[model samples]
Target: MTETLLVTGASGHLGRAVINDLLDAQKVAPANVIATTRNPENLADLAARGVIVRAADFDDPASLEKAFKGADRVLIVSTGELDLKSDRRLKQHQAAVAAAKATGVSHLLYTSMPNPEPVSPVLFAGDHYGTEQAIKASGIPYTIFRNGWYQENLFLALPHAIASGKWYSSAADGRIAHGARDDMAAAIAASLASGSKESHVYTLTGPQAYTTNEIAALVSEVTGKPLEVIQLPDEALTEGVKAAGLPEDFARIIVSFDANTRSGRIGMVTDAIETLSGRKPRTLKQFLEANKAALLG
Candidate 1:
């Protein structure tokens, strides 16, 4: 009998990517994997492909326990609910951690941010840090993946900035090691399949770090669109992001990422991705060059 693996938030980008890697690259039998989401309908295609689909809402502990049952390992993809007024995300993460422990899951894994310091200025820092604490306290053998910023996150700001010729940010001279989302997903899948009983913490990151200006230059070179990093005060950057039609909360969150970057918190680099996946992660330029058409458009 194959050891079952439960993956939460399976409808999301990272979750779906990890499922694909597990099935295709790692050759994990589809019947051995359980893909959990709040809405199982969203994963109809995956279910049709022989992968088990279950509804597991982070906010719903019963569903999490049901979905997590019989799994040898579980990957808790951190929730994205960013309500600063309350500890909603952290609570949801804690619920999942609790469910994993209650269901007797042997090895637990989590996708967390790089350097999830308690005092970090980033708005989402507390969520990951709190979840990490809860996982440690649960006494389950766990692998905490301190994932870096995604190279693909550039799409959030860079495209519009390219169109307007100004990339507003508060990152200053700080560098960011941005691994591709697919690369990170593959690494996570590899670790989940490794069947290691020993607990480990891995900081997954790009091969190298690059400052905002350097990244802007790479974008310019790839898309043939001249772009410049326009550093702004944190307040001004937040306002500008909101002015561009983003929600006030989301805009503020984006600005916090930049502020964290400026504080030198997002610049950490590591070879964990390559070491775990057995493949060198894509460089920033490589990611940029491959997505040139989309970036240009």
Candidate 2:
């Protein structure tokens, strides 16, 4: 029997991209793929394409286990819940890992960020670390992909910066290797469909790393939009983010991203994307060039 592959959070950008690549590029039969989300209605298109769509709530273990039934492999896309007090992100991840184990998944995969070790400044690094530990302790074969920051993440900061002709940062001289979200998704889909039972961890990143200044220069070149890179102290950036209407907790998290970067924790470049997907991950410049319009706006 062909392995039944299930991807959780199918309604999410990464999960949906993975499922699409699985069908269109990896050539995995739609009949053998199961897409799980909280709202099955969101994946109606995939369902229409003969993929099984099941409602799986990470907070509801029974629902997750039922949704994962008979799956030979499963990917747990990390949840967005970052409630520090409740530690809901780690709990949700643990719940998913438990459900995957209970349902007897042969192989498990997880999406994690680079340098989720304790020393990382990112407030939510703990969530990914705990999830990886849980997946390991579950006694199932697993692949942990420590995904790099998405090139698309620039959308969060760039559009505003471009409009004002100023890019402010606390990531002084820090370099980051940004992988295109879709490229990362495609690579993940390839690995999922490859049916490799080997349990291992890999870091996926773009072929090159660029500092904030370099990224800004490239953006300036592509969009003909002049930009000035303004460096600020971590505390100042945190305050700025807070002043921009983000919650205090969120501001801290945003600042910690720069902290992590400044500490040289997120600049690792690897060939894993090409090795897995059989294609080079898009360069940051290419990503910028393609999304120039989006960046300009």
| Candidate with best TM-score | 2
lDDT of each: 0.91, 0.92
Candidate 2 lowest-lDDT run of ten? 80-89
Q: How close is candidate 1 to the true structure, as a TM-score?
A: 0.98
lDDT of 2 by residue, 80-154 (tens): 788877878898889999998888899999999888988889999999999999999999999999999998888
**TM-score of every candidate relative to the true structure:** 0.98, 0.98
**Residues 1-297, model 1: lDDT tens digits:** 568988988999999999999999999999999999989999999999999999887888898888888999999998879898999999999999899889899999999887887879888898999999999999999999999999898899877889998898899999899999999999999999889899999999998998899988888888888998899999999989888899998998899999888999889888898888998899999998898878767
Runs with alpha carbons beyond 4 Å of true place in candidate 1: none
Instruction: Return the number of clashes found in candidate 2.
Output: 0
lDDT for 185 (candidate 2):
94
Reference-based TM-score, model 2? 0.98
Q: Give me the candidate number with maximum lDDT.
A: 2
